[model samples]
Target: MRHFLYICLFISITINSQESIDATLIDSSNLNADQIIDIDNFETLYFIKDHTIYKNHSNKKSINYSNYQLGEITTANVFNPLKINLFYKDFNTVVILDNRLAEIFKIDFNTIQPYKNITQVSTGFDNTLWIFNIDFQQLELYDYKTNTTRFSAVPVQSDVLDLESDYNYCWLLTKNYLYQYNYFGSMISKIENTGFTEISKSNGHLILKKDNILYFKHKKKEEIQPVNLPKLLINQFLLTNETLYIYDLEKLHKYQLKIK
Candidate 1:
């Protein structure tokens, strides 16, 4: 009798369903990797591993190129045109590339040693890139042409969660708090509790993630709406238009999000 009751309880729990949470098991495609990065509006998918950039496109075809090392790719700048930014450590350097993955120019930060630390970086406009420097808690503007860095006073309160940017302001997350920073790294406004795990921008709005869920916030809206995301790992998530990409150990899965 005891064994029968145990089996029944297991069956009941297995059959139980939760309506509020919708989940679908997505198959793992033959995407070889421990991760994916640089999902941007620019269309091409670029991921770094073992000193190479594995690229895929609209046709579902994929290929790899010997480009930058994973350790050297301090950050991947997907926003730039047909190029990715390479940042290397212990050298205080930045490298830019062309569409064919050719090296264009390099910014040697060793020359700009005044800054205590380069906390963050992203692709910027007019032959320049954005830099977040810990020297004086400032958001720094670095010009590739002049090979110089300028500091703008912004509130660099110790607990910055995540950062994203357009040509204008910097979007950030901190313990569920969201903030917008101008080019000078000054906070323009405080947004709602986005629960944003990571942030990116396109079409004048902020794309955010909360607990493996995607949310979209228009410029003027006070709140963000939950987006339809396919089945993904609890600890990792990635999203783009129409397709949602998921990552886990040695596997990359792709799913089409059903939008209403």
Candidate 2:
């Protein structure tokens, strides 16, 4: 009787584990991620997904890579005309890429005076770049042209997870919340988030990448729905009106969103 009970328990446990895995996979597979975000910005060298940067413009079997050697991709941004910023995990250096994807500048905090232990980055609005230095726990600005800083100020006493900027406001993501900063370092009203797993934005729309699904904020009463996808652990996401691109742990999934 004891042996029989053990066998029954083992069988039940195995079945439960398999069922859980199947449930997660089923939910992911049901998601038809058809919205393939067109990262082909004419001059775009490649699309950033799955902690790796690929030059999608290449038609040959060979492709270029911008792999993270530190640990994982910490932060990334592409600001028009041909400027890209890539920050690695636990590193004080950031790579600045120009239109040709060539290295233009490398900001190494170790060489700077008391600017070591850099943590976060924000790039947008004119030729400005915002940086968070752990040593001082303050926000600093860097000028792309002529390479100079005019001013900086701190708004919150917390670690920033993401940063988005426009002509009017700067969106700072900290932990589970998002904060807004005016151009002159004034606080704007906090935007309440419903459920966003991985968020990415452009000049047009705000993308909420949650779970195995993606949501686009449209009208006040209307929001885009979640599309199915393959089992994905998306660390980086990019979205457009017609396309949605999810970079998972091992592959890049493209979806064509149907807007009805």
Candidate 3:
């Protein structure tokens, strides 16, 4: 009887451990773009086509921004819709765009004092930018208004694969680990990388992708749970607070994350 009870308990634990979160297909639409950059809270679509950034709104006419001289746009950050950040790595420049895709300001790292080779840039609070200074191998919160760095994190030895931030926290995904830092430049959490290629943040939770599979890491949980999604060819993906958007070259599918 003792052995039989132990066998039943083991089976119950295995069954519970194998259960995964479900993602229901809420909506889908045809998407034709070279890449899907982001979908804002207002349902505005931002994408890239032929080296140009395009913004498509439901109620407004589409507008695009392009600079052939900049070579190529390395990244487009729509964290602040009013102040979109376009990073041109080849020229070491950042172009700030308004809501209508109009260039409002430009920052050329080449012309800045104490030269910074910025490989990545994201929106920071109150007219600031979170930039990765390759020269120092550090992540610096730069005050573009004052032309100075407010604070910087410790040097990261590995190559940074992705950088995403909100108003209060910054997350960096390196080749070996994923790190989260607070606004005061203090390390919050560090999780060893397990082949994660991309990351997106929403409401303090982390959504990570390894190849084509998606994983979710809650701010309060240490375990990274796999998001059970229907089989689809994932070319690009975006994670919002409640929805997971996946693009498969021809169509964009929206899945509602049903976390229990």
Q: Pick the candidate with the highest lDDT.
A: 3
List ranges where model 2 is wrong by over 4 Å. Answer: 1-38, 42-53, 58-73, 114-116, 135-138, 144-153, 166-169, 182-186, 193-197, 211-213, 218-235, 249-251, 257-260
Q: What is the clash tally of candidate 2?
A: 13
RMSD of each: 9.3, 11.7, 2.2
lDDT of 2 by residue, 176-224 (tens): 4555566766675465555554566555445666555566543232333
**TM-score between model 3 and native:** 0.92
Residue 50, model 2, lDDT: 60
Q: Estimate each model's TM-score.
A: 0.70, 0.62, 0.92
lDDT of 3 at 138: 91
| Highest TM-score model number | 3
Q: Taking the tens digit of each residue's C-alpha lDDT, what string does model 1 give over 199-260?
A: 75654465577776666566665556565455555344555554555666556665554433
Q: Global lDDT of each model? A: 0.61, 0.57, 0.89
Off by over 4 Å in 3: 1-17
What are the clashing pairs of model 1? none
Order of candidates by lDDT, top first? 3, 1, 2
